[model samples]
Target: QKEVEQDPGPLSVPEGAIVSLNCTYSNSAFQYFMWYRQYSRKGPELLMYTYSSGNKEDGRFTAQVDKSSKYISLFIRDSQPSDSATYLCATLPGGTSYGKLTFGQGTILTVHP
Candidate 1:
């Protein structure tokens, strides 16, 4: 089983709403984390990545990680319908095997206008 767990949400929100996505993991070995957004019929797109405990913001999106709690989060400000997609969280332990990653069951979100 994957070490990471997240709510498999078909989450719906109004346009301009603030949307929050979260994940938790049991593996203390995981040292790197990333979030991806996938649109229908398309491969997952890398949205953001975090390597340590802190918050990283890019425009309207924010990714936060707390290693002490083994928690990770993504927040979207002023959400838009274009944001509709399946979001995936990925984790990797720093090692030679960068190809090996544990992934959470994706959370689907739709922002309605």
Candidate 2:
């Protein structure tokens, strides 16, 4: 099975709604968690990241990690149409395996105005 798994959601929501994205992994070596946002025809950009198990919040975005369960999540508050994009959940094994990120299939989200 793939180390990281996410729902390929063509999820649609109205503007101003709260959005939740989730991913699960089976790899125990993964120590860092990341969420990337990719707009149409563009490379993914790092949206948020967290080390170990915890929650990291920045403005409208929140990233959470749970090591015990090997799960991660991203939450977006006050959604906007511009926020529509493909969001990917990624994990990296720390130490010598640096720079290697395993990504999920990505979930598509559209916030309609």
Candidate 3:
């Protein structure tokens, strides 16, 4: 199995819709989970970071990690057209390998105004 997998979704939602993106991984050695949002032609900016399994919330965004099932998720509340972007899930090995990340195929999201 690939270390990480995600549906490359071109998910479209109306403005103010809630959006959810998810990824699954097969590696138990992964200890860090991250969510990144990338605009066209721009490098992805880290949106969320979590150690092990838990949840983290930022304004309009919430990230969840479940180490047992190797699943991670990002939820966007009150979506906007400006929120349109590709969402990528990434993982890194714990300890010394934490700096190097392995990424899932990103999901494209479009929030229409």
Candidate 4:
């Protein structure tokens, strides 16, 4: 299996829906979990970062990690059309590979009017 897997969601939601995006990883050696948001052709912007397992919340975005299950998630509280973007989950391997990231294919999210 690939080290990481995620649905490439073109998930559409109404103006204030709660949106959930997720990914799964196979390697136990991954130490850092991160979420990134990208728009059009621009590079991704870091949205959340967590070491090991736990949850981190910032404004409309919340990220959760479960090391035991090798799963990670992102939750969007107040979805808006302006919030529409591709969400990518990434991880860095432990030890020497800690700075290098492996990314999921990314989920394309669209918040409709």
Superposed by TM-score, candidate 3 places the C-alpha of residue 99 at a distance from the truth, in angstroms, of 1.2
Candidate number of the best TM-score: 2
Model 1 CA deviation exceeding 4 Å by range: none
Per-residue lDDT of candidate 4, residues 1-113 (tens digit): 77989999789999999999999999998989999999999999999999899999999999999999999999999899998999999999767533688999999999999
Runs in model 2 deviating more than 4 A are: none
lDDT of each: 0.92, 0.95, 0.94, 0.93
Which scores better on TM-score, 1 or 3? 3
Model 2, 34-86: lDDT tens per residue? 99999999999999989999999999999999899888999999999999999
**Which of 2 and 3 is the better model by TM-score?**
2
TM-score, model 2 to reference? 0.97
Candidate 1 lDDT tens digits, 1-113: 55899999889999999999999999888888899999999998999998878999999999999999999999999999999999999998866355587889999999999
Candidate 4 stretches greater than 4 Å from native: none
Q: Of models 3 and 4, which has the larger lDDT?
A: 3
The window of 10 residues in a row where model 1 has the poorest summed lDDT is 93-102
Winner by lDDT: 2
In model 2, how large is the Cα lDDT of residue 47? Answer: 97
* Candidate 4 Cα deviation (angstroms), residue 68: 0.6
Q: What is the alpha-carbon lDDT of model 1 when measured against the actual structure?
A: 0.92
Output the TM-score of candidate 4.
Answer: 0.95
